[model samples]
Target: MSKNVPGIMRQKPITPWLYLVPSLIVMFTFIVYPGVNTFYLSLRNADNTAWASTACKAGESCWGIFENYHYAITSEIMQTAFLNNIKWILIMVTGTVALGLLIAVLADRVRYESVAKSLIFLPMAISFVGAGVIWKFMYNYESGTNQIGLLNAIITALGGQPVSWLTEPQINTIALIVVGIWMWTGFCMTILAAGLRGVPEEILEAARVDGANEWMVFWKIMIPQILPTITVVITTMVINVLKIFDIVYVMTGGNYGTEVIANRLYTEMYKSYQPGRASAIAVVLILVIIPAMIMNIRRFNEQEATR
Candidate 1:
């Protein structure tokens, strides 16, 4: 009876993976499987016919690694798309974050702070595609009649020639950047305002007692204290700029030299019917965004650990 009791007392060892089964299954099905399939498809020829035939014959299709990648890099459209992406990142990220911070600071102490912020934040409520369409109408060009485009209308009213807003390659990029800034500035302001609220009033009062002017206090005191929030805002803006697709797609459709990485990917896959090339573009986009995301994660973790 003692031997039977001892045998029954022994319990089964716990399997660590038992707790992770659901998450593991979800990741495997959603992320891992799709990523592997995309990478495999990216190695095949443009039309996907060769890959389909090879798979039918031998249960697998494998073009040499980097062949599609090489083609994508060498292609003229892809090159232009890459350059446009760089331009978007530079202009959109800087403009939105800087302008948003300025506006946030100014509005914080204003008489009608809520009204000012609400008006600015209105654009953010609109979908990117919808905003693009609205801007497109506002930029419409006519040959003979007075321009209806808001910018051109003002120019014509001032006795200046009406310039094409979306047609001119150099100006078109800037125009698109303006739309992005309009849409995202509110997001930056909201985040920065919250950060501003977190600043201790006693510290600000101490600065005042030390005879620091408003400008000095802002630059030395407020800016340093809110640096973490600024980092997060800039990082978020960078990721958004990298993934920008809908506005450019709706406005220019990668035409008039306004091509971007995501737009180029869409054209390659759907318009040009080149799955391999599209997959290569997708992979490159993933590579570009991964570092930014990793840095943001690290910064967030560090902030949390410090807290």
Candidate 2:
């Protein structure tokens, strides 16, 4: 038996497959099956009892096999939700990365750097639901009563009228995006801070020695060095913003024009009982996320190769 080592090596490669069995089983069971089922359900009617072809009733024009997908694309609510997700990607990602980078650079030069970073990152420890509820109160409005919400209280104290943070359609989505930015800025700061720490001090000193002011050194030297890290952060934020759900659900239940893709999926699935529509939304969301995910993977591979 001890002398069978060479013989064992010559045998079929079943050992690796055996090791992979459990993982493959788990992946198929949890990820693969659900994804396939979702796509399958997307082609059917609301409860999957009928083909999407029957979605047309008599005089109604039929969209054939992809009625749900059509609805996902053309429906007003879905269009609004899609646009909101795009808005989230634009504003929240920009604000998060910009503020994070600025704070990271400033914090690095400060005396209590650790404390400063810790305070900024504290919001990340809170669950999104919790953060939403906290901000909900912070944005609360009571017209007749004395303001209890912090923002309104401050505004009223300064002789300004209370602002409707959540109800107004014009600014509600922006309000939600603000909460997202606040919660995620700390995460961006921590990652960018690590990137900043990796910069070669000699290059920075040399640039300054060549008469580059701090601003010029930052933009010309530090930024280019950390551009990869910034790209990763931006893509990560994009993906996060695309699938934003918990906070929107907790705070507004996707009301007042704050709808996003994931929130719309939840609404269709649970509230409206439109499983087909929900599945269509899910598929669309996956498609949207794929590009960002691919970029992130490429960036990771490049980093690994350079190392």
Best by lDDT: 2
| Whole-model alpha-carbon lDDT for candidate 1 | 0.84
- Displacement of residue 51 (Cα, Å) in model 1 is 6.3
Tell me the number of clashing residue pairs for each predicted model: 0, 0
Report residue 295 deviation for candidate 1 (angstroms): 0.7
RMSD of each: 5.3, 2.2
Top TM-score model: 2
Residues 124-190 of candidate 2: C-alpha lDDT, one tens digit per residue: 9999999999999999998944998999999999999999999999988898889998999999999
lDDT of candidates 1 onward, in order:
0.84, 0.92
Per-model TM-score on C-alpha atoms? 0.89, 0.95
Clashing pairs in 2: none
Cα distance off (Å), candidate 2, residue 159? 1.7
**Pairs with backbone N, CA or C atoms under 3 Å apart (clashes), candidate 1:** none
Candidate 2 at 247: error in angstroms?
1.3
> 142-189 in candidate 1: lDDT tens per residue?
765478788778778888888888879979988998999999999999
